[model samples]
Target: MVDILEKLTIVVKRGKADKNSPYPPDLKGQDGADELTAEALKMGFTPDEVLQKALVKGMHLIGEDFSAGRAFVPEMLMAAKAMKAAMKHIEPFFKSGSVKQKGTVIMGTVQGDLHDIGKNLVAMMIEGAGWKVVDLGSDTSFEKFLAALEEYPDAIVGMSALLTTTMVNMKGITEKIKEVSPKTIVMVGGAPLSQDFCTQIGADFYSPDPQGATEYLDALVKSA
Candidate 1:
């Protein structure tokens, strides 16, 4: 069981999705995250074990490598693809309430931004890290965010903006959210954002990369 879990970790980190997935040449023809996850379940490992031990661990490794410059965006994308393949098998447990998630994350690109690349990537990274992600899509409004918050009171909010002009909107959105739910955690990021900008906007956290964001959230989950 441990060995299968390790293999699942490697396949996910290498971005192998299945026996036919050909993205990572080094892993061609090897059983991928998709297959390994099913095998693990067949081998009697629980869904939570497969999630926390293999899928999350694999993404964490690639994320840390990305943060340290040992990996890059392409690698992260492939890793995410692999994780998604595995998630096809594990998702049912979440719907069944048999596997616990770290927490819910409400993700979106701020209103008027029309940019979703960075936002989508962070959503995938956070989902790979064993959390439930509710994507609000690009050009999201404050009312929609608030509605989602009302539905998921304990969720963390992540906002993205690609334009300098649009980035300014985060300040107002963050203020409104904090005013409504003082305990809600707000995360802001985008190419134009900085730690100082994040502080000025009154957002609770900021990370330049998806991995950094996931790490911070994981720490928060552990502490909680």
Candidate 2:
């Protein structure tokens, strides 16, 4: 049902969680991402189809809107909520190996950066893009990151820093990861980050927004 799939996308993009969610006045009380995703599954739609076609498609639109400044944190947060609600029904498939993820992505905020909004956004976007995201939360240290890498050898590392002071710690963390696992790719982001700074810190990529990070990871997975 192309029509149902399209509605799922709209529900996600509009941040509808379920019939009870009232944030978006226009579609209040309408069946949101939760019900629609479950309905799609009941209709025999494959999990991969729901993820790639419905979820990722909707996230891409939100990402583009964020990149163009058409959407702010509130909008993106709502989108992430919708994505999570949809994911609740499909995560079991991933765990059961019925739906394999593109890759694992280990993410966290660097030490001294207690903020989690940026890190959470990146993690949500990455997960919505079909990666198995291992979120380490805020104020994470190098040892913790290295431990996560050891657990998921093929995972790419994403580090976030909201404060300029804490951004320097990203360099130390990257170096440690490279020293232990030279092949690991480290991506850095947050308000104060720049591409040149990312290079200086020996990180592989730097994205100002979640959409950019998603695109970078998608390209990397495709190439790999």
Candidate 3:
């Protein structure tokens, strides 16, 4: 049973979606995350257990590698794909209340920014870390973010901006969120953003990498 779970983790980390997936070369023809996840469930592992012990563990490894420069965007995207394949099997459990999420994260690429690669990566990382992510997609406005907040009152907000021009919008978004929900946490990220800029914008946190964002949210859940 443990071996099955371990295989699931390896497939995810190696970016294998299923037996049909030939990604990463070496693992071709072997069952990937999709199959392994189902196998774990069939072997009587609870959804929560499989999530924490296998899926999340694999994503954590990939996240760390990404942060260390050992992994690149392509690898991270592949890993996220594998994780997504596995997640499909467990999502029903989450909706049925058999598994609980750590928190809700409302994410978007701030208005005037059409970039979504960075935003998507962070959303995947956060979702793998056990949080429910509601992605607002690119070119998101302040009103869209606020609407999401109103729906999920306790949710955290994550904003991304790949362009220096669009990054300025984060300041206004953060201010508006605070106006409505001062206690809500707002995290900002993207290439043009710095810790200094984050502070200036009044955002609660800033991380250069997806792993840092995941860790920050995890700490928040633990502290709460």
Best by lDDT: 3
Which consecutive 10 residues in model 1 have the weakest lDDT in total? 21-30
lDDT of 3: 0.94
Between candidates 2 and 3, which one is better according to TM-score?
A: 3
Instruction: Write model 2 residue lDDT over 1-224, tens digit each, in one string.
Output: 77788999988887888889997899977999999999999999999999989999998888889899998888888988999999999999988999989899999999999999988988988888889899999999999998999899999999999899999999999999999999999999999989999989899999888988989998997887
TM-score of 3: 0.99
Clashes of 1: 0
Compute the lDDT of residue 120 as modeled in candidate 2: 92
TM-score of each: 0.96, 0.98, 0.99
> CA lDDT, every prediction?
0.93, 0.91, 0.94
Q: Which sequence of candidate numbers ranks them by lDDT, best first?
A: 3, 1, 2
Residue 19, candidate 3: alpha-carbon lDDT: 91
Each prediction's number of clashing residue pairs:
0, 0, 0
Range of the 10 consecutive residues with the lowest summed lDDT in candidate 2:
10-19
Kindly list the per-residue Cα lDDT of model 3 for residues 79-142, writing each as its tens digit: 9999999999999999899999998999999999999999999999999899999999999999
